[model samples]
Target: MTASWTVSQMPDCTDKTVLITGANSGLGFEATKAFASNGATVIMACRSTERGRRAAIEIRDSIADTGATLNVRQCDLASLESIDAFTTGVERDYDRIDILCNNAGVMAIPRQETEDGFEKQLGVNHLGHFALTGKLLDLLLENDSPSRIVTHSSGAHEMGEIDFDDLHRERSYGKWEAYGQSKLANLLFAYELQRRLEAANVTDTLSVACHPGYAATNLQYRGPEEAGSRLRLGLMKAINAIVGQSAAKGSLPLLYAATARDVQGGDYYGPDGVGNMRGGPEQQSSSEASYDRQAAAKLWERSEELTGTTFTFVLD
Candidate 1:
């Protein structure tokens, strides 16, 4: 039987603890609110402490009756040092992490390299999350019941092609192409992680991927120099108005993937509307390339090498 992807149907998460990267705004912010309202302890892992505090306050105010607590911590996904600090802090405080939402990301930014010399988009969107998840694997495994890791992907992954030689985009770069590649990496990592989990007999944890179906979020406006031309900014706003759904609505698929009882490992989800661009939640298939096991395996190796992190769960 097919499962319904509605937030209203989400199982009660009163005792659950969720950590969402990039919880300062947009879909992450809405998701923070959703989980907090359900009585989960929400950790907002953001790059900016100021913004993170504001977001946590806003969420707390919105869900006062639930008595859920929001913790704000600083973590720059583009930097390995920051990732380590964030994980260490979490380890010092929390004993178990029930849900990890790898949702922080940068999109369509100008060609740039992170401090580690990796491309900005790939570093923040994939490798950083890869390292973070690896560091926190012990805490996730400590949970006796099913724990979840939801990696946020995008429909743009359909246009992505992983170029191993130019993974850093040093030779050539286009904003959208690099963004798509990073998003594709997110899905590939999710699937590959699930494979490794099952092979290692780690039945208590699940890894899943999800997309927010053209949500009206700050992710749409980010760029190299913030779109200097009014015409360009106007054009983007026009496109968003024409196609985007509200952030809350767009977060349903992710919420479903993270919390739905019947969801399986490696399931990909998106909106259930025209072109899968803007609507309610539903299970959706990704590109044929995304399902290539060989590519996924290679990507997994490259990710481990790049991030210098390895999973305890070995892939067969």
Candidate 2:
């Protein structure tokens, strides 16, 4: 896991198609920029079309090669309808998908519901990507080349415990707890998907999970800004400046998981330095709870029920 890897070491991505959620900003933007720079047609699936297009334009200008295409499209992970439309467009236009980065997520925001009446963090971070991956499963499996589905997790997963009885946090909800649950679900889903893919004897699509450690990005500020707590926001900014790595550095684990040939299915990667706060991407262990088979199975079923999205693998 520690072979001194970086995005620049990524092999040529000619003819590859990479779809990234939240691609207009932060870590997603870094992912998009790298993939496009390396010749992959990067689809910027963002919630905001205007911002997505603007980012595409900026990235287009930054890259020297004109063959790297950027498609700006709207895909709101908070809304199922938006996700469906986004997938429909991809299916209509693209024949194969080389990589799908489930990178969009919400952090520790106040208790809320998505368009489908699920917890804000769980719905957007886990359920929405869960559904999108399922909807596009066939396209990914059909690809002749190796493909990957990289789910973004966090170190907070160590503190997370799935409460199935109140998964939606209908009875009680804490901001940090909810966020932890969602991030934990990310790993659970990633590992479980890999298991299923292998069991079905599918070799082309690999599902992996990774954490950013501690990165300073706009994501860190959204929660505080939404709560209108300038004090907390200021404190977060100060801490990030002192400790957080740049968004590009934070996105390394994601890119590594997505493109690295050494990466294996079901592998969980993160920073190797102290506290796993910030460092190079490396294979690392996640929380013990993240590896629970029974919980992952139950959560998978629950996710299918909640999202009405069931994965039909291409093992045949």
Q: Rate the local accuracy (lDDT) of all candidates.
A: 0.89, 0.92
Among residues 3 or more apart in sequence or in different chains, the pairs in candidate 1 whose N, CA or C atoms overlap within 3 Å are: none
Tens-place lDDT per residue, model 2, 203-225, is: 88899999999999999998999
The Cα error of candidate 1 at residue 272, in Å, is 0.6
Off by over 4 Å in 2: 1-3
lDDT score for residue 60 of model 2: 87
Worst 10 residues of 2 by lDDT: 1-10
Residue 61, candidate 2: Cα error in Å is 1.8
lDDT of 1 by residue, 1-316 (tens): 1334456677888889999999999999999999988889988999999999998888877775776888999999999999999999999999999999999899998888888988999999999999999999988988867899999999999999899989988989999999999999999999999998988898889999999989988787777236566676677788888879899988888898989877899999888888888777778899998888999999989999988998876323
In candidate 2, which residue pairs get closer than 3 Å at backbone N, Cα or C atoms, i.e. clash?
Answer: none
Q: For model 1, what is the alpha-carbon lDDT of residue 182?
A: 95
For candidate 2, the clash count comes to 0
Go through the candidates in order and give the clash count of each: 0, 0
TM, every model: 0.96, 0.98
